[model samples]
Target: MSDKKIEAEVRQFTVSADDDGIRLDRWFKRNLPDASFNLVSRWARTGQLRVNGKRATPGDRVETGQIVRVPPAETPPPTAAAKPKVERPTLTEDEIAFVNEIVIHRDPAAIVVNKPPGLATQGGTKTHTHLDGLLDGLADDAGNRPKLVHRLDKDTSGVLLLARSARAASFFSKSFSGRTARKVYWALVIGVPDIKDGYIDLPIAKQPGTGGEKMHVDEEEGLAARTRYRIVERAGNSTAWVELQPLTGRTHQLRVHMAAIGHPIVGDGKYGGQDAFLTGSISRKLHLHARRLRIDHPDGGQIDVTAELPDHFAESMAYLGFDPADGDLPLDEIKFSETAEGKRRAAEAAAKSRRKERKGERRSRGNGSEGGRSNSGGGRSKR
Candidate 1:
């Protein structure tokens, strides 16, 4: 309260270690509680706000020892309404217990959960009940709720990771974007793939009419998406249990790729349609599950964890005479760049580079020839 002054005066603050990887707006909330977000936006827009002498935005992360330049604060006009703070929804006893039961692994930096099928990760229109809304139950003693770093489809069950703090969230987000995190998923496709172990190199784009909720293979206009799958066991041509590792993260990449190859995941009506179902007691739940995750931790070592299958998936495996013990197959000990698709991409890029080099060489030779002719003719090209 004492820092608030009517006279125009600029202020600068050094980012502390605890505020290392948080957003610029978040820093304002923590240090200068009186500074409203509207004021911050105005400062950022006019180039009055800066981070280490460069113009900065609210979303930019601040590191330790960085200088954050702030504009002068002024008393708000009488008409300006105070910004309202959003609070977390209260959870009932059962809801609190349900979230606590899903936690599989907990550390200082991360929390892993065994999310069940039919439970969405975040809420959306017409989706009032989701894991994100119940996160208040998972708050630590200090009331810091973990943040979701990645997402799983509403019907996909398995290991989902959460960051305990903003620093960990930043670190994990980078790991995922950089492709250093490894995720293993298990699914039962209707039919077996002929090539037991291979890559699905397909480009995907949002489908035309589904309002961006659906994805399809679009060779010309799609983003590059790849998945590596290996058939673990076959059930007499009825269904096959496969391990899928996505090399690129795309919306519905696994489901789309599997259906594209004539084998759709069991119970996936969105992509597989009516043929995705099976006769008998098999449950009509999506057969895909995120089996395992391995990623570097923010503090020191790595976090490797595997989730247990839900009741339906487990029963289905037993009915097909497949042992659950064989589900956790060792991840391929080969680098992604060593795959067949990787080699093809590398070759294509190299060829393009060679073409450019050849064109440059030809241009250089033409210029040299012209220069020689001009010199011999006792003339020179003007600069």
Candidate 2:
């Protein structure tokens, strides 16, 4: 390697067609492999790095011909600035086989899998193996890892969607964010709901003391959450199979809503307490399952799919004499009244989405597939 010192000056570069919509940090990793995340973050915070004369965040997407200015990087001592490179973990043979067995449908644009219960979506603290790690099974021909369009809880097993390419990912994510996608989840609650077919309109907030991924009904200082549930069948008064459709995608929304209605999903001890348990040889695993997903396909059509129940859930249903055949009922769309705040939010979102749509149309006309974009606006949001 040459021992020349880096010049203490600013440098600007234009984004190429292939690199459109990629994160600034990712662009740096590809263009300047030696730049560390810490260095990029520090440079962004100090305004030493910018895009088209504007301050650039590491998460910001650089468009074609956008001028990205980078300050001269200081070369610290090799031993002091040695940053470890993160290598993506590969799936084991068993994991790959498991993925193959669970995959219900796949195409060039998307892969729909019947994710089993007890598997986390993304990796986190005290966790290593996850659905994200095992997604190599659905990688594209170019070895691009599929993108997660939505999330399901670790304890709830059901249909999970993944996009095969960046363009498809953008389209699906925008569809989900824009409320064009519909979801149907099935669960066995402890008690039969008195109001068999009604909506559970309640606000949900992060419980202050749960110390983990737990939520509570807090109409005062919480986000608006709503779910419509219909009782499909009941086994005595102890358990009932209910079909649910969530209007807003909040963390732990379904679990919290059912519990709020005094018929917590069976085996959801995190919120249901003692009532979550049942006697006899019935399984204690969470009974929630994502039964169906309906979304607009990237290829200009609708993709509606259903997932079969997991083994434990199937066995439990058999033990309770709850037939699965009768659970298939056409899903109904639910509507809500627009409050003052809701109207304001709706108007703002509509305007922003329209601008993005126009920008996408212009880009498509100029660059075709290379500039294809969705309402997600070239990149995913922070949260």
Best by TM-score: 1
Query: Candidate 1 regions off by >4 Å?
Result: 1-79, 336-363, 379-383
TM-score of each candidate? 0.76, 0.71
Q: Flag clash pairs in model 1.
A: none
- The residue-level lDDT of candidate 1 at 7 comes to 51
Candidate 1 TM-score, C-alpha based = 0.76
TM-score of 2: 0.71
Candidate 1 lDDT, tens digit per residue, 1-383? 01334456787666643344568998798667677899888899999999989999999987644678888777668899966766667899999999999999999999999999999987777888999888888899999888777789999999999988877876776666555678899999998899999899998878999887898999998766788999999999889999999877777889999999999999999999999999998889999999999999989889999999999999999998889798788875656476433554688799999999999999999999999998877754443
Q: Predicted candidate 1: what Cα RMSD to the true structure?
A: 8.1
- What lDDT score belongs to each candidate, Candidate 1 first? 0.84, 0.80
Best by lDDT: 1
